[model samples]
Structures are given as structure tokens and as C-alpha cells.
Target: MPKLWNETIAEHRRTVREATLETTAALVAEHGLASVTMSQIAKETGIGRATLYKYFPDVESILAAWHEGHVSAHLEHLTRIRDRAGTPGERLAAVLQAYADITHERPQHTEIAAVVHRGEHLAHAEQHLNALVRDLITDAAQAGDIRDDVAPAELASYCLHALGAAGSLPSKAAVHRLVAVTLAGLNLSPSTPDAAGGDD
Candidate 1:
């Protein structure tokens, strides 16, 4: 009976966490990051304010949960792109493109991304992203696809900013414009453009 109670509690916690994330994302989509409230999310999730409080202490906590989900999804996509994408340059392009697509498709994620990025919590996530990007940058440099002189940390900062704001575009046409401009900073010399395409 004790084991069953524990299992039930665990499942309930999982449900609340998932529901909190969904509610936060929805509120972000409807009202933007600054407007979302823990009260609002509790109402949306059909749980009492006290129950919601038990699950997440504040609005930022909900946002943190939501951010965790987005980061996991983003990392999965990046890993797949890194492994299966063509060429080191193409991998970088694909990673950014995938990120751009996600922002456009999930405005809530974009909004939360913007809000979470306002402070040090996001800075930690940024460091993780930057390190991953640095690895890719090193590989690209080895293949002579990206400029060796540019530091990986610098490139990661630019890419993260771009990816975080990708939903700002008014239309698909703007995506190409933004991506083209961002890619231009990523080595893009005429000699490198024609390099054999394959990440392997």
C-alpha cells in the first residue's frame, strides 16, 4: 500500500509538472511573457491555486519548467542535425534553420526564451549551448569551412540571440533575409562555400 501511494504521488507530480508547462506556454502565447501569472496558469490547468502552488512556487518556476522542455527539444534537434546534416557548414546552417523554424512555429517558446534570457538563469543555459556550438565550430574550422580566427564563444552568442528572436519575422520571406544575414557572419568566403558538403 505504501509503494502504491508513492507511485500515485509520483504520477501526480508528473501530471502537475506537464500541466504547468503546457499552461505556461499557452499563457505566454496568448499574453506574452510579462503578462503570464501563476494564478492564471492555475486557473487554466483547472487546479486550485494552492495545488498549483504546491507544484510550482511562482510564475518563474513555471517558466523554468517550460524552458526545460524547450531546451530538451532544441538539443535533440541540434544533435540530429549535427549527426545527419551535410558538411560542417551545412550542419551549422541546419541547426540554426531548425531553431528558426521552431521559433516561428512556437511563439510561446520564443516568448519564454526571450523572458528567461533576461538574467543569469539563462546565462547558464547559454553557456551549455555555447559549449555545444563551440564543439561544432571546432569541427567546422578543422574542415576549413568556418573562419578559424573567430572564437566559438563569440559565434555562439550571436547564434543564440538570433535563434531566440527568430519569431520576430513577419513572414517566411523574412526568414531567408535574417538567415542570410546571420550566415554571412559565419565564414561564408567564396572559397568555403563550395567545400564538399557532409558533416561526416
Candidate 2:
């Protein structure tokens, strides 16, 4: 059809898809993932069943799309934080803290995770995350802020695994402490008593 008409139609479809994904996530969170249904999603999203089917084949596909969007948003958020004005060390610290907080704050939707976590998006996200942190580590190491003994990629992997513990941390304070410990491991010039004045 007309160009404007095509653009408008595309926008409308996006709106409908967004609404469906949001409604389905809420329903799954409130109820259980196993308990959610396409009919329920259609009703909650205020869209006809046929229209919902046009967007997603079933509840599983809808959840997968929602998860992919969620993961992409998270990656975008970290990119923004990394690009913000800061010294390499400062930006690295901020990124690590933000990542820890994200892990801590994410809801423990075990059922939904089991269904959606297996998608290729997870692998892509993991690669993106590793590269982002690896680049940050390289910058900070070059600046003499982070340790250079370990390879930046290896350090990035270590940070990812260490911070992953934040997901089960009891409180925000615990998460912060975990970040601090992780950062300490990366410190290039860890504090030590002056050899010339050990006892003053």
C-alpha cells in the first residue's frame, strides 16, 4: 500500500506485540508459567485470539520473544552505562556494580526461566556480555587501574562468574560486598605497608 499506511500498520503491530508480551509476562509471574495460556494472554492483552495467534504461535513462543526482548534491553542498558563519561576504572566499577544489582534484582521466575533460558538469545547475550566486560578490563588494565597479569578475557569470565552469586545474595548490601571483593581481585596496586616505614 502507501508508504505512510505501511509504516502505520507496522507501528500498530509493534504495539499489539508489546502489549501481548507484557500481559503474558504479568500473568505468568502472578500465576505460574505452566498455568498461563494463550487464551488468557489474549484476554489480558485485550486482543482477539486470532490476532494474538498472528503474533505468537503459543505461550512458549510468546515467552521466548519476551525473554529475547528482555535480554536485549539489558544489554542496551549496560552499553549506555559503559559509554557514559568516566575514567576507565570508574566506568568499569560502575558497570560491575550495575551488573551485580541487575542480577540481584531480577525476579526468580524459575518456571519461566526453565522454558525460555534455553533460547539462542541467551548464548548471544553471554557473548555480548563477555566482550563488553573484556573490553572494559582491557581499557582499565591499559590505564594501570586493573591487573594486567591475567588476560582480559579470563578476567572478564572471572568477574561474570563471581558476580553471578549476586542472584542468591540475601540483600543489596551483600551484593555490594560481592562487587567490592570482585573489584579487589582486579586491583592493580593493592594497598601494602610502605617498606621504608613498616612500623613508623
* Top model number, lDDT: 2
Candidate 2 vs. true structure, TM-score: 0.87
Output the lDDT of residue 199, model 1: 15
Across residues 129-166, which tens digit of lDDT does each residue of candidate 2 receive? 99999999999999988889999999999999999999
Off by over 4 Å in 1: 1-9, 28-40, 105-115, 118-120, 161-165, 189-200
Per-candidate count of clashing residue pairs (backbone under 3 Å): 2, 0
What value of lDDT does candidate 1 attain over all alpha carbons? 0.71
- lDDT, model 2, position 46: 81
Tens digit of per-residue lDDT, candidate 1, span 6-107: 567778678777877888877787787788787888888877889888877888777877777776777777778778847777777767666667776665
lDDT of 2: 0.86
Any idea how many clashes model 1 has?
Answer: 2
Assess the local accuracy of residue 3 in candidate 2 as a C-alpha lDDT between 0 and 100: 37
lDDT of 1 at 196: 40
